[model samples]
Target: MNEITERDLLDFALLTDFESFLKHSMLTLNPGMPFLPNWHIRAIAYQLERVRRGEINRLIINMPPRHLKSITVSVAFPAFVLGHDPRQRIFSISYGSELSLKHARDFRSIVESPWYARAFSQMRLSRSLDDEATTTLKGFRKATSVGGVLTGLGGNMIILDDPQKPVDAQSKVRRDSLNQWFSNTLVSRLDNKETGAIIVVTQRVHMDDLSGHLMGSSDQWEVLSLPAIAEVDEQVPIGDDEFHTRRAGTALHPEHESLETLRGLQKDLGSYDFGAQYQQAPIPEGGATVLRNWLCWYDRPPERTTKTKVLLSIDAASKDGPQNSYSAFSAWQVQDGHYYLLNMERGRYNFPQLRDKALALAQRYEPTLIVIEDASAGIALAQELRSMGRHRVKAVPVERDKETRLFIQTSKFEAGHVHFPKDAPFIPDLLAELLAFPHGKHDDQVDSMSQALAHKFSGYTLDNLH
Candidate 1:
C-alpha cells in the first residue's frame, strides 16, 4: 500500500472544494490582495456544483458588470472543473478575441501554478500546445471569441461571458449575428448529446439580447438573475439544496459597493440605462410609454389652505387566491388644476383586509369622495364603504381598458401636472410600475392612478359633493 503525503491531502481538498480553490487561486491572479467572497460568489459556487453533478445542462446567469462574473464563471470554474477531471474539455466564449485570450491565459496560469499542480499532479498541459487565444492542452481546454471559426473543436462544458458589448447591444444587426452564431455553431460543438453543459453569464443589454431571446423562446434553461440591487424579494438558488433570499432594497454586494453609492450611480445613469444595466430590465426609462421629463418631484404638498378637495381612488383585485392581483389605492389632493399624489397603498388582500385598509385610509384622510372602478371586487368594496355612511364612495364605470386610460393620462404627465413626493419609500415602486407601463408585471398602481385622474377631470364640483 502507498502512503499519501501532506501535499496530496491539500491537493485533494482543492480538487473537491470549489470555494476553497477559488480563494487559494486568487493570489495567483492578484498577488497580495485579499479575496472576499460575496453572496453572489457563494451563489455561483453552488451553480457550478450543479453543472458538475449534471443536474442542469443549460444555465443562464444575469448580473451587473464589475461584479466578478467573469472571474467566477470564465476563470475559476473552468480551472476547478479541469482539476477534478483533467481530460474534460472546456470552451470559453466572449465578446472579442482579446478578452477571450486573456481568459485563456488566466485559466492556464491558475492550473499551471505550483499549488494547483500539487493538488492535481495528473493534470498537465501537452508539450505541443500553443498558449494563445486557442490554447489546447491536448483536448483539456480551449477559448475562442463568439464568431471565431471552430472546425474540429468540441467541449464537454462551454462558458459564454459577456457575449454582447454594451455599446453595440442596441444594434439589430449585431444582436442577430451573435444569436445566429450561438444557435447554429455553438450548440453543435457540444461533445455529448445528452449530458454536455453550457453556462451563459452576462448583464442584460437589450430586449433581444441572447439572454432575453433564450428566456423568451424556451424554458429548457435554468435562469439565475441577480440584479445589482434587489428590486423584488427573490429566493435565489445557490445550490441544489441551499437558497438565499435578498429582500427588496438590499444591495447584492454591500461591502464592495455600498447601497448609497449604488443609488448615486442609478441616478447618474438615469432610468433608461440603469434599468437595463443594473436592474436587468431592458426597457428604456421614460420612453414613449412615459415621459421622463414630465415626472415632477415635490418636497411636500402645497399649503393646507391651498388644498381644495381630497379624494381616494381604488382598483380592487378580482380574486382572493394566492395568485390574486394586488388591490391599489391612490390618495390625491387636488388644487390649482394639479393633482398632488399624497399616498399610495397597494397589496394582495382578501375582502376583510381590503375593507379594513380602505376604511383606515378614509378615516385618516377624510376624503370627500372615494372613486372605485365598478368592476369585480371594486363594486362590493364601494357598496360596503358607502353602507358604513362614514365616507362618500362613488363607483365609476370604466368604459375603456387600462391601456387606453393610461394613454389618456399620458398627456397630463407630459404636461408635468402629476406630482409625487420625493422622499417616500413607495416612490421607487411607483416609478418602476409607471415607467414600465403596459409591459410591467403589475398594473394595479397604474389603474389606481388612472382612476384618480378620471375623477379629477370629471367636472365634479365641491357643491355636488355627497
Candidate 2:
C-alpha cells in the first residue's frame, strides 16, 4: 500500500459529499464503509463516474438473486452519490410498496448512521418524508414512485431496483403489468438531460423483463446479465468453467487472482445449487416425471428370446398425404404398468409401405397384439392389414386430452413403476418427452406412444368396440 495523500482523500471525500467530508475527517472514510466495494461495485462506481461525466444515459446491472446487488445499488452506493451531488434527483421503484419502503429505509439508515453524521457534519436532510412522489431537496425535486412520463426534465438519476417481485416475475399477467409500468410509467419520465438510470436485480423469470428491454439498445443502456446457470443447450457446461471464463473476459478479471480459489467455493456450498445460484447457470427442470438424478438410469436389455410376449404400437399420422409427419411404430413388452420400448420405426412412409412394414413387424415379433391409434388413415391401414391376413391389428383412438394422458404416464414414471430396457430404441426420445411434457416442446412421439400404451394396458382393444 502506498502513502495516502490529502488530495486523494479530499477527492474521495468529495465523491461522496459533505457527509463523506465529515466521515473522512473522522478517519472512518474507506472503500469498505457501510458496504464493501467489491469488484461488481467497483465496476458500477466506474459507470457511476461516467454518469457524473455525462457519458452514459443508463447503466443496468442484471445479476442473479441474493448477490448483494440491492445493498450496493439501492442503499450504500446511492447514498455515496447523493453525498457528492446533493442536487442529484433519484427515483427508485420496485414492484410493491413494501419492497420500495424497505430500500428507502436502508437509504435512511445509511444517511442517519453516526458514521454518516461524522462524514458530513454540515449535511442537511429533510425531516418530513413527503407523501407525494416528488420531494424537494435544497430547492431540487427528487421524485419517488413517479412514472417516467412524470419526469418532464427526464430523470437526472433513476434507480430501478428489483422492479419485479419473485412471484410477480413468474406470473405472466403480473410480469406484463410490471413491464407496462417500466415502459409507460417509468421510462416516460426521462428528461432530455443526461438521465442516469442504474438497474440492479436478480432475474426470476424470462429474459424479456426490464433487462430484456435494454438488450438491443446501445446508447441509452448497458446490460450486465449473469444467470444462475449459463448453459445455452446440451452441448455446453453452463456452470463453473463457463462462469470463470466470462469473469476472465470481463473488466473484473484482474480482481480475481485464482480460478482454483473460486472453484473452492463449492466446499462451502453444494455443487448443484452452487453451480446455479452463484455461477448463474440454469438447472435442468426436474419434477414429478423422471427424477432429475435418474435421467441417466435404465435397465439392461435381456437377451433376445422368442418366448417373450411381444407386441407393437403404431401411432399413424394423417393419410391425407405426407405432410411431413411420420408413421411412428413403437414395439414394447407389457408387464404391469411398465412398458419396455424395444424397437421404433418413424418416417414418412406411404400407405402401402406402412402396411407392409406393420405386417412384417407383426410376423417378426409374433405379437400377442398390434395396437394402433385409430385416427387419420390409421383405420384404413388396420383394415387393409387385416384383409392381408393380419388379424392381430387393432385400431385404438385416444380417449382424453394429451395432457391428461401425460399426467398419468408422468405419475407412473415418478413412482418408479415404469420399466424400460437399457437398450431401448427410443429411450432418449422417451425421456426427453417425459421431461419436456406440459412444456410443449416435443410431445408428438409421447402422444402416439401414450395412445398405444393406454389401449394395450387398459385391456380396451378393437374387440371391445360397441
Candidate with best TM-score: 1
User: Which candidate number has the best lDDT?
Assistant: 1
TM-score of 1: 0.79
> All models: lDDT?
0.81, 0.54
lDDT of 1 by residue, 203-255 (tens): 98887899998888889998888878876566777766778877766998998
**True-structure lDDT of candidate 1:** 0.81
Per-structure clash totals for the candidates: 2, 26
Q: Each candidate's TM vs. the true structure?
A: 0.79, 0.46
Mind giving the per-residue lDDT tens digits that candidate 2 earns over 213-311? Answer: 455334557555443332221222222233223322122222432334334443345333343334443223453344555433346534555544466
